[model samples]
Target: MTRDQVLEFVKAHPASFMATVDGGEPRVRAMHTALIEPVGLTFCTGVNKDVHRQLVANPSVELAYWDPKTGVQVRVRGEMEHLDDLDLKKRIVNDVFTFLQPVVEQFGYDVLSLFRLAKGTSIVWRAAQGAAPMEVAEF
Candidate 1:
């Protein structure tokens, strides 16, 4: 798949799982895609959360998105960039993650940390392909 196609597929399947390294062990969690642009895929987490701490210590991450009906899976692997832009944080809180409003109220916007997968390699796999080689794209 092309890079644009891979990005579009991810945008369509925004509900995804993200994996990060905690110490030497691997940790995975369900995460919502905060935003998607030509630049990269963005995500938000609480600054006090373990995920944030892990990302800060080790920026490398991998995200997976799947479409059950289509049996399609896309995986993105790269290092994350911690974003400190207040405007982007406001946009994420006000638009994408309204549920964070209460957290924002309690700890302010800084409580919500933003990270972007600025550069990554994406692989697309289809169930129909079975064990065949997956299509890979770089962003």
Candidate 2:
């Protein structure tokens, strides 16, 4: 798959499983992909969440998007770039994460943290391929 194909696959399946490191131990969590563009895959989390603290301590991460019905998976590995733009945060709260509006009202936008996997290596796999090598792309 090409880079654009990988992005589109991720956009179609935005429910991602993210892996981060905490004190040399691996931690995984379900994360919603807030936005996807030419720039990167964007995500949002609460500032007080362990995921946020782990990302801050160790930016390296791997995100996996899987489709069980078709048995297709896309894995992206890279460093996480923290986004501090208030406008972007506001947009995220208002648009992608509407449930966060109540939280934002109580604690403001600073309570939310944004991250982007701007540069990464992506691997796409399909169950139909069996043991064959996966398709790889970088962006």
Candidate 3:
């Protein structure tokens, strides 16, 4: 897939697993992306969360998306860029995800952290248990 296709694919599959390293160990968990834009992919987490702290200590991460319908998997490796834009954070809580309203109200937004994936190489794997990637795209 081309870069645009990769972005579109990510948008199609918003629920993904993100793996982050903490003190030489890997930690991965399910995460839902807020959006996938030409600029980058946006995700949010609680500031006090371990994923947040792990990322603060080490910005490197890998995100994986699996499409069961087509048996395709995509992995993106990159650095996370922290966004300090209050407007963006507000929109994420107030607009994109109204479900997070209560949490935002409880924590007053300060507990939220926004991150954008940047400068990544995405590899697509298809239909095999241990096969090599079919294509690689840089974003």
lDDT of each: 0.91, 0.92, 0.89
Tens-place lDDT per residue, model 2, 1-139, is 7778878988899999999999999999999999998899999998999999999999999999998999999999999999989999988888889998988998888899999999989988999999999988886
TM-score of each: 0.96, 0.97, 0.93
Q: Candidate 3: which stretches are off by over 4 Å?
A: 128-133
Task: Estimate the lDDT of model 3.
Answer: 0.89
Highest-scoring model, lDDT: 2
Q: Residue by residue across 10-74, what tens digits does model 1's lDDT show?
A: 88999989999998999999999999888899999888899999999999999999999999999
The collision pairs in model 3 are none
Predicted structure 2: lDDT = 0.92
Task: Give per-candidate clash totals.
Answer: 0, 0, 0
Tell me the TM-score of model 3.
Answer: 0.93
Q: Name the lDDT of candidate 1.
A: 0.91
Q: What's the best-to-worst order under TM-score?
A: 2, 1, 3
How much is the lDDT of residue 81 in candidate 3?
91
